[model samples]
Target: MYDPKIFKTYDIRGIYPDQLDEDVAYKVGRAVVEFLKADTLILGRDMRLSGEKLSGALAQGIVDGGADVIDIGMVSTPLVYFAIADYGHEGGIMVSASHNPPKYNGFKICRERAIPISGETGLLEIKHLVEKGKFEKKPSGQLIRTDVLDDYVNKILSLIDKKRWKDAKRLKIVADFGNGMGAKTLSNIFNTLGVKMLAIYSEPDGSFPNHEPNPLKEENLKTLKKLVLKEKADFGVALDGDADRVGFVDEKGETVTGDIITALLSKEILKDNPGAKIIYDLRSSWATAEEIQKAGGIPIEYKVGHALIKEKMRKEGAVFAGELSMHFYFRDFYGVENSDLAILKIAELVLAEKKPLSELGRPIKRYFHAEEINFEIEDKEGKIKEIEEKYGALQNAKVSHLDGLKVEFSDWWFSLRASNTEPLLRLTLEAKTKELMEEKKKEMISLIQG
Candidate 1:
């Protein structure tokens, strides 16, 4: 039941039943409560079919460990974060694989204020406890079922200034929930904001009868792109399995990269809080930083991953932060991911500018971005070192080892790093010209993949 490999950098995840099962989940729940030394723990699960058994087992373990369980059944990943923070629970567990295939299931554990439990933080201790397979015998606690969706929606609205989006009703958009837990809150948020939403596959389905919930895959986004153009809507938004990540399609049926959204949101945020600091992942396009600076905001580049981003945002006092993976974090959201809040801000922009989504996204897209590419390699660290040494030797090259290897030349830049959740090396290259971007991409891929 305790698979050591299932313990990941940010969370615990693996294939269902085989790598992770009810027994493992039950042990994890007990371990988490004991690790946090808490009396109550908030729990939520995504739309995965195994979520029922896993959540039930987890809640029983928590209760057996003398920790009451506040089970907010069947919701998106974000709501668990909201519940932990809003209700002042000591810790929370979200039973989700977060964009993984249906065969996969995992847990995203968080502590007070919804702070993530990364490996460096306290995950190892929990793993140690789980492997021990022992819990102190105590009086069993109660299982409490409640819904925090209403409060979660209210919190999302409080973060957005409704006065600025008075014309949201005029905006028409398509949202592909991909049959995940996204509809749990996103559809409601859109409706409450008076946006004309054509939501497809909004029903929560673990089987994902349509396309998989992962919007990062271009193939999965085909339906969304076609719908946006067919309906002639302002834009389209696609949410991942758990709605913690989101992707956008312009009205012209063009896919909008997450870094571009980061750039746009940075500018929008700076309008209200000039000279404030903004955080962006190092893999983002240079346009993100330039736009932040142009809008009178200080741009700070941080390491990738949701856990690292939240820590950096709080440390830097950043008003907003976004990743190339479409995960946007906000100070208003208490340093947590809120796909609904990001959409709300985007809606405000569309309503206020009255411009096509493509036009609105055009300015910050000054540089050509090679969408992140992955390579299956055995010696991920060794490859990164070899590439780093070669690039770091270049004259006038600005290199950073912040997350992995990032070397910036005058016209082009590239980043290479191992994925935290997968055993693969990820590369992101950008340049001033399309040809240059392609050229650099080829040059970098050889060293990393070869």
Candidate 2:
């Protein structure tokens, strides 16, 4: 039987060979082509050892389904998206598990113009087709090998202000690639922009020789923080395995949350395009929305997930959108997350301001946020309902059921959402004061745990 769990909300991912292997990968490829009714398909993979085999199997299935394939080997997730949109291909596939461990790999499929095919989109259709296991064999389609690295770089550079970058004071920056795909793309971007870069673990090692590529966890950022401090760099940035999202460290080596990055970038983007709508996920700190409005940009809140955010950006004609998970989306990027742009924008912000990142970020750092806490529970949905019911009774409390149960009071707010994949409930609480944040966190955790 096909492993249903591998078909997640965002992509198809699981342990290699056991839950996901060559056979499944091939079927997914065929199913994607069949579902999209496409003639040409683009494909790429990360540096994982299994990527090559899985991508090859996928290509075989695509060819068997009589679809021409443009195979760009060993690329980041964003690059795959770039290729599809750049070449005007009908669809594309990226074999990557993103920040997941090396043993896990998956496929991120996109439709025409590089639009994401999530569970709510066309992912379920592909899953059903693959499970049926009946594919007509047509004459095999030809495979073409091409590289879009130069094109991708040129496109991004065109969006940046070369004169401003050249005129700004040279700043030293540190980056930890986590031995993922960032080393390949970020190095080239930085080198072209002529920034002093002290790179760590920049090599593309699927083994994740240093730490896991996920910078959301504070522990994963320890080494980057140390390097930034020891080197006394202007600031630092870290990218996940596939380089679609990024994390930041200030000059003082303090990890900057994604919401702060969102606020900062929103201010920058709005300076150029005032009144443009800026989208942030619901879980983001209130400061994100406040800062966006302060910058004269319309702040719009949406549910989390790249697919959802991208759709919202397109629908709202948003200038930029950010997720708490470090994914930053741009309208210029065909409504997809591109951390490369995010890194450049941050560098420009620091260089132009002539202040440390922490100092620049201080104005928007106006809240106390209890970082996301996850609890494994059997009755995840019931627990969320219970938390909502408990908190919903509070006077002047507002509850929003967008992606989860978010109860907002005058001074504090908390959100409880059931995990889409795991049997877990996640909580995020924020307040006007640290004491209040702690008090609300404790009060909510008790309800969730019980």
Candidate 3:
């Protein structure tokens, strides 16, 4: 039996054995085969404890449904995406709970060319098919094992110019994988690039011995921050469970927010592809858009989510897209999110600038931002409307309900949205001054919760 709650806006995710088990995995396997009408598929899993069992059961179901499987064992999520496109498979599935606790596990599924299956785009249908469970029986298809590690590394490495390699070698970097699957590919990339790297929690451990794999949380980034300072490294990098999302700590051991990194990288990319369109989620800091425009690139704000961002990237012919949640997508990468590419782009930028990461980001860190805060509110929609009505009357204020209620003023903006997973209302506010941000935050909180 599968829990309906696991069918999220973008992927399938839930606690293992209880909410998600081999039975559910098998059903999802069959559902994907039928829903995508796939003849062949690529499959991979992270270092979670239940990965083997889940992938085994899922593969059995897929093969039983008469679709061949190219099993690329024990890889990061992006590697699975790479395998699907690189090998010309019809679709793929990755068994990873992505930044969740070790006891939890789930799958990220995609059709040909790494197109995601989400709630509005086939995830619900797959869920319905699984619930129905009346699958057609057919002769099992082949399950072949393949290795994509070297090819994946080489392909990403090719994106970097050889001249930058020498400068990269001069840099001392530190990486904290949080005992996830990042070390598998990252170690290879570092070695091949001849860069000096201090790897922390580099070993793949499903138990997450050091800390949680999530780097977005300040607590999770503490270790990386310390190591970067202690080693005096050029910068520090952190990746989530499947290594698709990345986080950074500057040489000063300061944790950089996702949008700041976006602004920095936008400057680098825009230098090469001038006037290119870049996508930033509405929740991101105004610095992202300001930096993009200053760098001669067109900035477009889109609703958040990997599926939506990728769709916008393709539609606008955007060179890149960055979200406050740490997801970065690239047009060159078949419109897929790739933390590895973000790393390389940072490396190139560092080489070109010849400045410390912290110094490089100072200009873009002009604005004060309130970290995303959530309030447990029963009337989510009504509260959002109330705040909208109160603020919408302000002169020169712009309101957008794209993904939530966002009000923009000359010096500040705030977004209020209902959480998709819980009975909570989320708020994020930013301003030109810390005092303004504090004042508005207090006002917003009182209005939202009171």
Q: Tell me the tens digit of each residue's lDDT in model 2 across 227-344.
A: 9999999998999999998999999999899999999999989989999999998899999999999999999998878888988988999999998999999999888999999999
Each model's lDDT comes to 0.90, 0.89, 0.90
Q: Which 10 consecutive positions of candidate 3 have the poorest summed lDDT?
A: 159-168
In angstroms, what RMSD does candidate 3 have relative to the true structure?
Answer: 1.1
Residue 298 in model 1: lDDT: 96
The alpha-carbon RMSD values of the candidates against the true structure, listed in the order shown, are 1.1, 1.1, 1.1
Off by over 4 Å in 3: none
lDDT of 1 by residue, 284-342 (tens): 88988988998999999999999999999888889999999999998888889889888
- Quote the lDDT for 322 in model 1: 97
Candidate 3 overall Cα lDDT vs. reference? 0.90
**What is candidate 3's lDDT per residue for 183-229, written digit by digit as tens?**
87888988888889899898889999889999888998887888888
Q: Which of the predicted structures, 1 or 2, would earn the higher lDDT when compared with the native?
A: 1
